[model samples]
Target: MAKIYLDPGHGGTDPGAVANGLQEKVLTLKIALKTRDILNRDYEGHSIRMSRTSDTTRSLSQRTNDANSWGADYFVSIHINAGGGTGYEDYIYNGSVSNNTITYRDKLHAEVMKQVDFRNRGKKRANFHVLRQSSMPAVLTENGFIDTTADANKLKSDAYLDRIALGHANGIAQALGLKRKSGSGGSGKQGYVEVITPSLWTYNTANWDDKAVIVNEGEVFTVARDKFKVGNGHMYQLKSGLYITASTQYVRYYTK
Candidate 1:
């Protein structure tokens, strides 16, 4: 399992940057929390932990130490940029770093910029405390310029934040070579099964029967096993395994 560490820039007493009634610390924390949730729910099997779950204060050293102690596979620090700059930029330590770190940083930077409307500041090398001190591959992302009115307005929307979180999750998934789950049968082919309408059965055999039913016309049904037989147009299985069939009756098929 891939272990990830999320650091939301400044918090509590320290608001790293502020502009247009938006605090950098608050925005960073919000994005980080959303990103963590997305990773946990969508990225299945991976372990995700945060340096600070709420608006709690944590120093740079403390955050790095926490990540190291947790034995994180990757560390990402989320922050917003100020000082009249516009666009997104990612920073890595400016020394002899492994190629793996550079490649992962580039992937993350590209993914984030592709989703945001901000300018692409490009990947950069810097001696930031967190990046320099981290023993694992680490990156600090300046999401956007909080000082800019357009960017600030975009940041205010939850939809935009969700897209950013998705981009972050996608990048992490790509870097870790995560596999997407196949819906059912492990292939696109719809497995064979028999459908039993209410009119054909006197009682609900599914409750007591040991056979699996693959699909139902308009409702949900549990699959019992791959092998089954149809009686009165009703399919049955071993009751131990089954595939839930989705609605495809109205879908039109065409050959290319």
Candidate 2:
């Protein structure tokens, strides 16, 4: 099992960078949380831990020390840039690292860039504490410049943030070769669902509230649990731990 350690940059009084009414701490935490959520819900054979889950104070040393002590397999520090630049970039330790470190960074940077429509700021090497002190392969991502209006506008959107999180989650899973959890029912019967409508909204829960993400028509998702009662209707539990309506009006189910 891969042990993934996530650090949400700054927290508490040390807000890191702030601009365009966006705090680096807040955005980092948001992305990190979503990334963890996706990993836990959609993937298997991996364990995840975060440096900070809420608005609280944590020192840089404390963050690295925990990962080192735990012998984490990979460390990812999520942050927002504040410099006069824009777009996305990532960094690995400037010092010598295993070949796997560079490979992981390359895969991660590419995946993140593919998901977000931000400028490709290129991959770099830095002596960042989180990268240098971690015992395993580590990457620090500067998502976008918080001070840059164009980047800030994208950062402010919930859908955009979800994209950012999805990028990180996808990269991590790919780099580590993590296996996706089977959405098949308890009977081990595999099934799939396709969106028949022009668009469909998925929820984190079986209820109507807490919409997780939107999927376009023809998009397919694995059904973890075929169908279960939700109110007077029914919902399909996806492998990602998300729920979507089982109504034939929006989706069609297929046994695979």
TM-score of each candidate? 0.70, 0.73
lDDT by residue for model 1 (1-256), tens? 8888889999989988988999999989889888887666555668888889888899989999999999988999999998887878889999878787898888887667545556678889999999998899998988888999877877887656765775677677667765654442211223332333331221234333443333343333333442222331223332334322211111111111
Ten residues in a row with the worst lDDT in model 2?
Answer: 183-192
What candidate 2 gets wrong by more than 4 Å, as runs, is: 183-256
Model 2 TM-score relative to the real fold: 0.73
lDDT of each: 0.68, 0.87
In candidate 1, which residue ranges exceed 4 Å CA deviation? 182-256
lDDT of 2 by residue, 2-111 (tens): 99999999999999999999999999999999999878877889999899999999999999999999889999999999889988999999999999999998999877
Q: Which residue pairs does candidate 2 place in steric collision?
A: 183-224
- Give each model's clash number: 8, 1
Model 1 CA lDDT for position 43: 55
